[model samples]
Target: MPEAHEDNRPLIERIAADIRKKIMSGDWEPGRKAPTNDELQRLYGTTNVTIQKALRILKAERFLEGRAGVGVYVRNERPQTITPAHYIEPAAAGQSYRWLTEASKRQQRGKYRMLEVAEVTPPVEVARAMRLEAGGTAVLRSRIGFLNDQPAELVHSYYPIELARGTRLADRRLIPGGSPALLEEMGYPTRSQDDEVAARPATTEEYVALELPGDVPILEIFRVVYSDDERPIEVTVIAKPAHRFKMGYHIELP
Candidate 1:
């Protein structure tokens, strides 16, 4: 432990973060036994009380669990893989959303709650992606997606006001086949998409809205969909618990 002045965070928080790092980095694989209490104390140069407190933190966060005299072990809630390719296209007419269908293929019941739909000034990054002028507003659609009745993802999609002003994208009700289908009908068929993925701590709104279990990193995706001539049509931002999702991508080398 660094001097208190050097590392102002509480000892418990610091130690918990260290252990969480090991787990997230795959240095401590799931189902593996944790270090002995004495072993941890010696490693951290801390006391038994501090070590116990840190372990409790991890336990409450579901990263570790105690057994009846069997010692503590890492839990088996590793991230599941998802292939973005499986969900890129528009759902056919009269069909449900693509995301719902894809989730079903994984044996997980899927659902979503539309939280908001309105015209709002988008974030700078979103505006830039869609080439909206400063202070320009877009039609914003927000929802919380659930798997097996558990909230799992928060999605916000923005559409250019020019195209969405008189369409379902600006409506409060759920679109029958999702935005991609509606866009295709309006002649903005999705030609290609680009996604920038990242990870960071959740915002306060996300933490409460998603009922996050702990302070785990959130996987963030900023995706832009284009039509013919590479005209940007929609921008979507998705956030989910990073520890619970593993995005799979396939690349072709020439």
Candidate 2:
């Protein structure tokens, strides 16, 4: 419990803010029990309903979790960091999975299930990004990536059907060194990438696929990889649960 704010802000909001700060500042360790409801009530000198409301706010933010018979505790939510460098450097041939190499470096296991591979009419945006004509077919590689056994991301990659024909990208199995390496071998080495990121409510499919909380939003990334000639080689649309990832970037100022 904490002292109520002197301002007109709701008492529950003030109490939640205090507890949030404590948790973020490491005053409360993950998986450790948070102050009991009765204790919070006493600390804030507030009613039981106010204390409960405060706890509810923290729980919704995934900073806390309540047990049935037990008490509420801080949540052990570890966010994976994503950086541009991960995609810039293609993994070597005969190496571990390229798409997950970054996670492996962070000591987190990454695995993905290839949901489907088919040649279909590309979505409007995908066609525009990949420079394909309307109703043109593209090879679609759909996958779901998991981190520590939890669903983490949904990736849908589209490639020119002619370019991927008879290639592993059209195969149902996972590519040995990932698509980037294979593209390089085919003389379409990725020279640069463009990424557009946005945050929005998770769709039904995304929510179910990522197993995200109802209140959590999704981070959508539209990435285009280009060849030396600046031709778009591939377009990948990625959806990730907002709470499970932290995007990072390091720029060198000229």
Candidate 3:
């Protein structure tokens, strides 16, 4: 350990470095319990707060996880692949694969609350993407998605109004279960969807609506759905909390 200094490095940083070295050197393995605060205090002669700071740093670095009631344990393995932004094709469509519904679990951090829905004039971008005439009206569905009961994602879905008009679906409050499965039943099959991911700072609306931390980045997903003729019919934008969603994609190489 370097000599204790007053000005330069933080105690947590130094301790984190030492712990990292031990793991990198194979002194500790995956799934191993990290030294508790008491153990760390004994080993390093540090206070509980200092040890906790070090552990929190390691956890943010993906080196450890706390199991609620259980002790902090090392991650068993790093994700084999980095999450990628990709399109999802539903099975009823010609696409061979559908996203596993089993994998899509609702998080309690944010409440999935619908804000509003109404027939609105489609914006130029939406018109072009959905192949609708300018000045055409579409059904807009807006919702606030929460994590840990905290707002996290602001979701807005637009569909051609004719398809959804006169139906109770036009009212956001009338929707149930948070999934738009009714569209499929209406015969406008969602064959496939295209997703685009971009990194950017959160806007003020996002920060407040999603209840995001100031320093955390946001993952923006723009998804376009195509119909049987390959015409884009719907557009949905998902503003997700940075640390919450683990996106992944796979590609087959010949």
Candidate 4:
């Protein structure tokens, strides 16, 4: 079997990938019409069937959307590029969540819906990350995130019961400014963090929750936030459709 690399991909896939690259690189900005089938066929020196197949890939990935009797166009709501640090801070004492705050700054509507909340035994890795004893349980806060009314991310954050038992974190309602603020007020004060990112095929549940357009890989982030004295306060597992989002990181050197 051939390895899954650019060189080893079938012709149609490579063509689709190149077009995707153009869109991602901003060469083909959102709202712009994609090249016509005839034009794409001529450009790639391929047949209409191949061109159609390639375009279908982009459509399935949501990089393009077609209108009845009209041409395909780049999607208006472009994939979001999230800078982890920007939303890592606890929201101001009485403001909206940092997620909403940052989205407004970008001229977009950020929304959240609480999917579940319960004290449960988490996966072993989560248990280890939260430093809980074997068979220990924690408060789980699961939510689905939206941007411009479209589902964008699913987050499951686990908190130490000591910090959540009497608070909204254990409640099934959405947090006002997110749990980070409550954690701060309780004195843990999110002082630092660790992140582990991975890419894998979407789970059946995640595929349905994120409403992914196809059987595509999803970006999964395992994050642990700590407070003063290196105490872990929050451990979150985030899942987003891989084709519709990217992470940005910036480092400053003194």
Cα-based lDDT for every prediction: 0.90, 0.85, 0.67, 0.89
TM-score of 3: 0.58
Model 1 per-residue lDDT tens digits across residues 70-118: 9999987666776777777999989988999988888989988999999
**What is candidate 2's lDDT per residue for 2-25, written digit by digit as tens?**
998677789988898888777756
For candidate 4, write residues 63-168 as lDDT tens digits.
8898989999998866668789987898987899999989899888999988899999999999999999998999999999998898889999999888889888
RMSD of each: 3.8, 5.3, 8.3, 2.5
Error of 4 at 206 (Å): 1.4
lDDT of 2 at 86: 72
Pairs clashing in candidate 4?
none
Q: Compare candidates 1 and 2 on lDDT and give the better one.
A: 1
Q: What TM-score goes with each of the models? A: 0.84, 0.82, 0.58, 0.91
Cα distance off (Å), candidate 2, residue 109: 1.5
Q: Clashes per prediction?
A: 0, 0, 13, 0
lDDT score for candidate 2 against the true structure: 0.85
Model 3 lDDT, residue 233, Cα = 64
Query: Candidate 1, 245: how far from true, in Å?
Result: 2.0
lDDT of 3 by residue, 69-132 (tens): 8899977743222242322433443322122221243212224677888888866767778788
